[model samples]
Target: MSGKIRACYACQRNGRLTCRRTRLGEPCLKTYPLECVDLLKRSRVAFQAGRTLKEGFRLAQLEAVVQMLEEHECGFVDALGRDLHKSTTLDECLMVSEPLGVVFIMGNWCSPVQTCLVPLVGAIAAGNCAIISPSEYTAHTAELLHRLIPFYLDNECFHVILAGANDLPEVVELRFDHVFFTGNRKEGSRIARAAACTLTPVTLILGGKNPCYVDQHCDIAITAQRIAWARFHNAGQSLAAPDYILCHTDIQAQLVQALKCYLIEFYGSDPRESRSYGRMVNLEIFNRTRDMLWRSGKVAVGGQVIEAEKYIAPTILTEVVESDPIMQQDVFGPVVPVLTVNNMDEAIVFINKQEKPLCVYAFSKNNEVISRLMSETSSGSFCSNDSVLQSLMVALPFGGVGASGMGSYHGRYSFDTFSHRKSCLLRGTRFECVTYLRYPPYEDRNLSLMSWACTLSQRSQGWCQIL
Candidate 1:
């Protein structure tokens, strides 16, 4: 468990590992060999033995997880701070459902702790054996979890595998009851394809380019402040953050000015000097984000990028078009692009033309404006007059729609995601007379009686009541 391992050059060579450029030179990451088949066998054996099925056992494991988080809070914080340069914390079932035997969870790098632990929590609560692979890009956090999880949870039932992207193809080939993945669309597609070969169920939480509309009727200052906070937080690494702004042309200038002021207040004149702001996860992300900032639109606000720091200032791009490089992909950085539209209808049309997003946001004081945006546009979720707040609450089920993602999870939804609702019915021998009618050779009278019994009718007026 010593932190003396070498940097994972293998991870960087793979095209899939895009989130791994550390600020102060890459840290050494501990990776495991591809022993997934044996691990899956162990998990299956544990599930069959019914060790995880017991309520007491599940509760104990869950409690252990809470204790582990509490005991090693600083360690986790330090690991995450190193992995993604995060500065803050974010804070998530159901039916007569049983465990889905085993769950395979692949966490994302944006919020490594949350993406990994939230699904793990649900899997444990639902009484399933789980195998988790934290993002290799988030090396420190992944290695820390690999070390800490086995100590807290049952090593046989809940296992952590820290492997590079090259190992994923073989890992997904092995069978599991359910597969839960939080990542980009390309990698998620590959996982889906592999899972499909085994006919395994999957939940993909893929991030997309979420759009936010700014109406002339809204308070520009408040709207700008909320957008800036939501967009610039975590260096705009959040999947739920508003990707681009669609503002009315008349108020576009005002909104841009307001956003500039708020950005200065949130991260000071120089965001690179601000401790509250974070850096990109890796060089790949930094380069991609920087390219978008340079190729698209005029830089109305911060558009600075320091390659060595893997830093992109909290930037705002104006005069951006739909075809811009930034608009084409999920701008998973602290860059907010603005596209001016003549009105709400034009904005709606623009939004509808693209893939549905994780969430759709609209800022307006008018209730009708909010209602129109919510009703007309389709997304995983809709937030009015604000951004990124809808997915924070555990009460809300978080997910994406269409190309964005599939399935929801948070609170009870997570429990459901990892569980199989097995319907059951028990009857006594004494009730044999109630089923006598349909047991014999079928007759017209029997059909009539069955139909009457099944019909929904008022009391005392139906044959069901008489029976």
Candidate 2:
């Protein structure tokens, strides 16, 4: 059998055995699958073999990881296309590398190329092992990862686990050095809890109802077009994508009209036929988003769904109330809600009331406005006059706060995550009178001298202190 197939079989067998063992308390022959055990053994051996952090990884190793990612990228795209009927942009695929001993739990809505692969690459470049648990909603992508990892990576050093909701507790209990998760607030909490039991450091990348604010002074055409692209990209299933729009009431109508034009231009008159648009991952998610659309608020643009195909058309809602389902939820599918506000202060206030988002985007040329927003709102990252692109920067720290998530990693940050920084101090052999004074002495003269010496030593390193 091909290596990929063998790896796939191994993962499948292990997953079944793990689930069965977890649920029934059965005595399985293996505590973990052979592949997992082998990988751990190899990693431990590598660590013990005097492989310095710098020497543990090689450029060739990174290249190999990239190559494997590329090999699976084709399969991943095909699988995701089959699952969602939408292919991710090329910029997304270039991201996956290897693990720096930090694993990322990717979200279903994330493009396999960027969200799943790139973080993997970041970890690998940092010379760490990674264990990816892809979103269950994106089963095909997850399966592809299970197959490709062992084929491309050293089976003894890199691994992927196919886990379900029930297997989460066991997976989290493994005492991984670091845990990186991308999902909703509820599940993020559960992952955090599991990591806490082991005191494992965690990096959570979660967001809720991110806002895109447009000032009246902003360029309407550029603002609307960027907003439309950000809001509708990957059918609006991005953490950093604009969740809602806040604009000054004076320019709200104009901006909304411009946005409508841009949406039609980007996705065409019939977005259902647009190959660029993607579908919801599964029927459950489709129904959940559909219910959110039907039960709450007003639909200003598209609210149509093709249930059999699990498709929700590019949608835009206006005047959505805070109590509306769309407002309350993360809206992981392609649906944009636009809310009009009086000014930047009101917009800031509105954002402050909700959970801190993974990303906050503001479109304004004014430095003061950008400065004020940056200073006032707390987010994992911020994009001024742009959206979703901030995460692409390798130098910046990427993570969330409060309910959104925690920890940050990108570029060297990934290296730091997997590394244990130990401090060592060497004592010198030089002896002096000060050292002798520290010996036992209870006599008045010695006590007085010791006290005076100590006082002098506190003032300066001098001969008086040596007395």
Q: Among these predicted structures, which one has the highest lDDT? A: 1
Model 1, position 58, has a per-residue lDDT of: 92
lDDT of each: 0.84, 0.73
- Backbone clashes in each candidate structure, one number apiece? 3, 18
Candidate 2 lDDT over 1-467, as tens digits, reads 21211223343444332444435655444345456646655766777674534433676677788798778888966765565453211111112334335454444446654556666766676677777777777778888888988999978767778778557757887888677777778877888899899888777777677878899888899998888888888887777788888888898778878988998999899998998888877788789889988877688788899999988988878777888888888878788878888889999999999888888888888988997888789887889888888887888877787777777767777566555554333333343444455667567766665564444322122222223
Task: Put down candidate 1 lDDT per residue, 261-367, tens digits, no spaces.
Answer: 99889888898888899999999999999998999999999888899999999888988877889988998899999998999999999999999998999999999
Worst 10 residues of 2 by lDDT: 87-96
TM-score of 1: 0.76
C-alpha TM-score for every candidate: 0.76, 0.71
> Which window of 10 residues has the lowest lDDT sum in candidate 1?
86-95
What is the Å distance of residue 36 in model 1 from its true position?
59
